[model samples]
Target: MKIRAYRSYFIQELESIFGEDEAESFFYLILEEKHQLKRIDLALQIDLTFSENEIKVWNVILEQLKQEIPVQYILGNTSFYGLDFEVNKNVLIPRPETEELVDWIIKSNTKDSFSKNIKILDIGTGSGCIAISLAKNVANAQVFAIDVAENALATAEKNAQNNKVEVAFWNRNILETYDLEEQFDIIVSNPPYVRNLEKEEIKKNVLDNEPHLALFVEDNDALIFYKKIAELAQKNLSENGQLYFEINQYLGKEMIGLLEKMNFKNIELRKDIYGNDRMIFANR
Candidate 1:
């Protein structure tokens, strides 16, 4: 059948579940991925057709979409910080808010400003988005990442190689590690910060499909990863080093207080483009 007619049916089928705008976006993303057709191509050439086999594939994807699986997972890859990354059930899909976190780090430190290669460590480095982005953008950055899950680390290592960035991967649980390999010029994390009580706010696409191990923490200890990473940062960050986090927006005040108590200096809590307090930077 002609692509436009199928597109109409696709949008109609998903509009109630994802809303019209989102459903349309998903259609175009799949179009580009599967058929190499952009939205403008569809507009200019409305007579594109999918073969029987292609339509069967689209039907499988369509059903997955109806079940509210993330389109990135359906596609098996995603873009972050202008780089492509492989993603799956093992890693949290990188978010735009995280791109902002990465931009902040890249802007603050550049190779031209440093006399030597700066070392960075990313704790709970799901998908290695933060570390790899830094290694790619920040010149002279020797990046390292740590994650508890071996499979997640494997995915992240694959991302690093695909991005052509040299990042050392460590398969260690940050919460259990007292000593870092060495002092780092910067330490960053987007650790699991969502509390159990807040699960209701998560979209079904995320709650149902994304890895819970990379998403949730007990309500009573939502800051557990932060506390552990902070303690390690205190011990392992070089003089005048920086620490960054993609934090729980609701706990900005609490995060600031935690850094203050840890005696970190020049604490700055930043909001993402949506104006939620979503990231923080502190100095040693």
Candidate 2:
């Protein structure tokens, strides 16, 4: 089939689910990932045709998209903080909001100009997006990441290697232990902050495909991970060390209150691109 003809059918099928613009975007994304052809390349060769084998592959992906499977998972990799990360059912796909959180940490560290080696830890580091981004962007940063799921840690380790950054990966449940042996200049987490009550607000694709262990909390104790990480940071952070979180938008005030109760200083809550309360920074 001619490429443009196939593109038209693909977008029409997905438009109801993802909207016209996004459906078009998905076509181009798949073209690049599956065929190494960009939009411009497709445009220049409007008469380009797909072989029967290629059509079969495209049909399979289209069926999955109709079920609301995330495009990132369908592709098996995604761009985060300008680096490629392998993702699967075991790990949550990295989000743009989390990239903003990583950018904040990198900016703060660069501005401080710490001459000594900087130690950093990422709690619940699914896919190691934040940890690897920091290690890649910040000079003199020694990064370590922890996750309870051994499978997630395995993916994260591969991500670190793919990004050409060294990050220590540990498989440990943060809720059950506080056994980090070294002090860190910065500690960060983008933990499970979505309360069970908020599940309805989540997109169908995420609810259906992403790992719940990395995305949710009990509604009654929405701050569980935040509180635990804060307690561990209090003991493990060097004097005036920084702590950061990519937080649930609905719980900003509660997050601030939690940090205040924990006696953290210089607390700041920042909005993401959508102007929602999305990240928090505090000093230990």
Candidate 3:
């Protein structure tokens, strides 16, 4: 079928399931991934054609999309902090808000006062996005990452290797241990923070397809991972070490209080692009 004509039908069909914007994004993303054709390619060559085989593959992906499967999973990878990371049902597709967290870590460390040769740890490092991005940007810093799920760690390790950044990957559940066996200059986490009660707020794409172990927490213990990671940081962080978190926006005040109670100083909470309190940083 002519790819140009198909794009309109595809977009119109998906518009009922997802709004036109998302459906359009899905179209472009698939076009680029499948045909190596960018939006500009389509604009310049409106008569581009797709072979029958290519159309078959796209139709399969379209079926998955109609079922609300996340496009990253369908594509088998995603970009985070400008680095490619492999993702599947085993890991959460990196989100824009989490990108802001990476930006916070990168920008915070850019100040020379943080010192070269700084040691950093990324707790619950799904796909190693945070750790790899930090390692790539903080040239002099040594980065390590920990995750409980062996499959998730395996995926993260591949990402580190693919991104050409060295990151120490460990398979240990943060909730079960307080000892990192080494101190770090910075400890950052974008841990599971969405409360079970918020399931309705999550889209079917995420709830059905993303790994639940990396996306949710009990409503009664929404801060469990944050509290535990913070506790470990209190003991494992070097003097003046920085701690960062990609937090649940609703719990900003509560998270700051938790950090203060743990005696974390220089505490700050910042919002993401949507103005939700999405990140917290503190220092020992």
> How well does each candidate superpose onto the true structure, as a TM-score?
0.98, 0.98, 0.97
* lDDT digits (tens) for residues 1-284 of candidate 2: 99999999999999998999999999999999999999999889888899999999999999999999999999999999899999999999999999999999898879358887899999999999999999999889999999999999999999999999999998899999875788999999999999888899999999999999999999999999999999999999999999999999999999999999999999999999999999999999
Better of 1 and 2 by lDDT: 2
lDDT of 1 by residue, 62-163 (tens): 999999889999999999989999999999999999999999999999668788888999988989999999999988889999999999999999999999
Q: Looking at candidate 2, what is the lDDT of residue 261? A: 95
What is the full ranking by TM-score, best candidate first?
1, 2, 3
User: Who wins the lDDT comparison?
Assistant: 2
Give candidate 3's error at residue 190 in angstroms: 0.8
Model 3 misses residue 98 by how many Å? 0.9
At residue 234, candidate 2 shows an lDDT of 90
Ranking by lDDT: 2, 1, 3
lDDT of 3 by residue, 170-213 (tens): 99988999698999999999999999888999988889988899
Assess candidate 1 and give its lDDT.
Answer: 0.93
Lowest summed lDDT window (length 10), candidate 3: 107-116
Instruction: Give the RMSD in angstroms, all C-alphas superposed, for model 3.
Output: 1.1
